[model samples]
Target: MFAGHDPYLVALSVIVAILGGYTGFGLAARIRGTPGLARRLLLAGAAGFLAVGIWTMHFVGMLAAPIPPAAAYLVLPTIISFLICALVVGISLFFVSIGDPSRQRVIASALLLGAGIVSMHYVGVHAVSGPFHIVHRPGMILLSSLIAVLSAYGGLRIYLARQGGLRLVLSAVAFGIAVSGMHYTAMHGMTFSTMPLDMVPMSDGLVASAQVLSLVVALLCFVIAAGFLLFLVPEPRPRPLAGFPGGFYPASEAPGPVSEGLQTASRSDRSVMTTAPLGGIGQPRQLPVQRIPVEAADGTRLVDVTEIRAIRADAHYTMVHDGQRERMCSWSISEAETKLDPAVFIRVHRSHIVSLPHVAFLRKEGDGAIVELDGPQPTIVPVSRAKIAEIRARLGLTKTVPPRH
Candidate 1:
């Protein structure tokens, strides 16, 4: 017969689940903005932490249940259960992270993940061998499975939406509750009875005694706690621009007149930017931005303005294309236009800005036009009808009129 649960251990199990969810989802949110090896690493880390969290929580909950002293866990089956959880969780994340995930793909991934969780739970349960027979109620099993699927679906949706700050914390809390609820509900529907005197206990493989299992669970709890704390620390911001007094000039202020000797310094000698004093006065002279600040999930990074090929508006934010990939920026389209040098960067459309120096090709498309930007990943940015003529002139594509016949 099942005994009353240890309230302390039960609470610890829920905490582990929440921490795992928080770290996993936070890493997954950055996968979109990262490229190549970095993206793969983030994905792996996310999956590993999440799988460990699930496995850890289950065992902790199991420990809380006062099972008979005769019960011991089979080593192979217990390990296999964790592998099942990891494999399915990794597969689900892969599906959602690659390209644009459609509704069907998301739903399918969630179902797969849910099924994996259920399988892991049952496999772990069966791994326990003792002098008792376990019986489960069919209704409870169905209800637990349903809860797993629904919870997985909700978690995936929140991740895709990129809900940060308080929303992400709330989602993690909800996930912890659902995971714990499923475990306890299944336990509620199960009853244990003593086996017949003639029945022999299973002893085919290595088994973990309750004491040994408890130690392993305790170590894992520490690991999860450390990871949770590490994730809470804010990522470092981009370093200040070098060679400028009090860092770079504020957006509203321009650099004051420089001494003649400093202005005469060769461009090659200057590491960041060259300065000039116009008319020997303190009047503000418009200077092109040398670096643009962009945002990633981890922190802010400054992208070289020369490397930027195009910028497209994303709601209030902007996506800066630096030939290789597009990165989210905190600046709006209008704000980006004002900061960038007018001579090199042009506003080709209300929602789009392009670096004129990087334009490789231009052609008429419908009423508007299209521009092919040169980069590792070719980008085609659209030009609005009203701006088409301006873009053509900017790109030196304006046709000259012949002398009058």
Candidate 2:
């Protein structure tokens, strides 16, 4: 006889999934803009939590059921399932964070993750050796797979929406529920038949349920403690400097998109700030733009600096292209230029500031140059001769050939 509804394992699964959500958000933040050893570390860490959390939750949930005949898992298959979960989770995070958010890429990631999760669930289920024959319903399996894919998309969306705070918690809870939901749903779809009394004693896998549960519980404790310590470390609030303008904020304060201490061309310093203007002096300076909220006159539009493809001058106004739509801003291109971070937004023309991340590549076109942005349909913006050297340097190209007479 077996008793279901074990409280200990259920609780551990919840804890593990919540911690994994937070880790996934952090991993997404670290994946942006640049690639390095640090980013790789974030990827590996998040993969462990995301994969292990689901793996642990499923097995723990299985134990909570208290099924009959004292079933135990095959160690090799159980470990293999965990590895598959981890790899899928890692790949999804990689696609969402490191690459451009294309429609096809996002869909592919969701489907891949969904399929891997389904595979992991079944593989883990197969690990059990018991005195019962497990029968599953096809409809329930399909329904559960849909839930996993949607959950994958929802998780990625939340991470992109915000990296920290209550958003992370909500995303985690949703993820945890999806995991437990799939397990229980599949469980509900099954009807187990007990083997004969003589066959019961022939069961090979030894019960190590207690040992496994104990290990998961310990890991959950460690994850909870580390999460609080790393995320809860408070920062001293910055005292607002009166009238120094928004650029006065320290570079460390810059959020996910841009690097810290990114210099902007000042009114008097425009001549020395960027390459084409560096040797020249007394270029009219513009103020740095904070993440300003701008909308069209109809009040139906909004754009973020991070979303900008390029800003084109239109006399007294500037046009902002966010890859999806274009909106006109009241500010001139010069005024908008200073408000952008120099590291990621470069002055390609006197009339344009190109968003660096969207730039696919540069092309030299008949004694001039063009900067192309990445998307389904690419946009090419002309680069001025004066600003060409600066653009090259920004893209990390250092070798400059002198003009031949």
Candidate 3:
């Protein structure tokens, strides 16, 4: 039944839907892990739920506005508008969902979705009917998107800090409540309406409260879903025969805890590079250590080893040098790695390992090519060659690619 709709009322409906959409996406992402049929089904369900929930919420909120006799004109456009809002919000949430199973991702996802919903609603409101008129200013849209992204990032950081303990759940609750409250508070601000609160028993508060509760409860369900999904979809198992170093034979007889620890430390570095000292002029440098074997995820074999003369840790990753050879790696040294095995590293590239001290020059050609050292001489690291840019970045090289023709 169509009824009277006010600008503020429309805004309220959109905000509620945004909250619902964010909650739904986060829940779906957490519950669905695999990338096949099951995940698709779960995602479809989430999208449907978001579409219906937002549409219904807004439809009800627009009760104050006069309805046109052209119901058909309204229905289709309304569905499309609500869907666009939900999809934008859901996509933001999707980005946040790919990170580690931390509370931060959930919160970030929620905030991003919320902000998307809000921005889209405001923009839509400006276009359709509201106290604010559409400006069609690209700057405003960019600014709004930027703000939303920042808020999402902040939410993610907060969530991450509060994950893994009873405090995590508490933080989630607090975050959800805070967001829901903020949504209502902002919605309430849309109008130049200085009108006093229209008291109709607890009905208004009840609806608002229910929506908030739903958002908070949905977040908790997402947490559970994420946990279970993580459990179900195990990490990628390293191939046993990918690369085995001479000493790294039997899984049991692999390096002891110390070596294991070192490998772990290397893996965690994430931006390590190994380079060999350049000859006379400013050239590549080698790492201090030499002959470190790259370990597979499975402790069974060693993918490869590099010779480095020096090591440099990048802002985000690690680098190691072995003579003229250079290798870039993501694995970094952490306290945990100090207690692991020596053969626990991964060979992301021919010239790179978990260690940053064994990388040579990373060269970009057609696909990608890395130049590393076998002994003291530079050996062409066999890689796809497409990964060269990635290698350079990992090595902290600042050279940019020439423009394509």
TM-score of each: 0.65, 0.59, 0.32
Error of 1 at 141 (Å): 0.9
The sequence of per-residue lDDT tens digits that candidate 1 reaches over residues 20-42 is 88888777766665667988998
Q: lDDT by residue for model 2 over 1-405, one digit each (tens)?
A: 123557776776666666666665554554542237866887887777787677777776777665764666677777788899989988987887653456677788888888888899989887776778777889998888888888877776666544135667777788778777777777667667788857664544444554675575467557644864575566554443332234342222223332212333332354234222323345554444446444443343446677788877644456566776445565656556656776678767656778988988897877669998876556678885555666777787768789999
Cand. 2 TM to true fold: 0.59
Candidate lDDT scores, in order, read 0.78, 0.66, 0.40
For model 1 the local lDDT of residue 29 reads: 66
lDDT of 3 by residue, 48-73 (tens): 55544444454434343343321112
Clashes of each: 0, 3, 90
- Ten consecutive residues with minimal summed lDDT in candidate 3? 200-209
Model 2: runs farther than 4 Å from truth? 1-4, 7-12, 163-166, 200-207, 234-405
Model 1 CA deviation exceeding 4 Å by range: 1-3, 243-246, 249-405
Off by over 4 Å in 3: 1-26, 29-32, 46-77, 99-115, 123-151, 154-189, 192-405
Query: What is the TM-score of candidate 1?
Result: 0.65
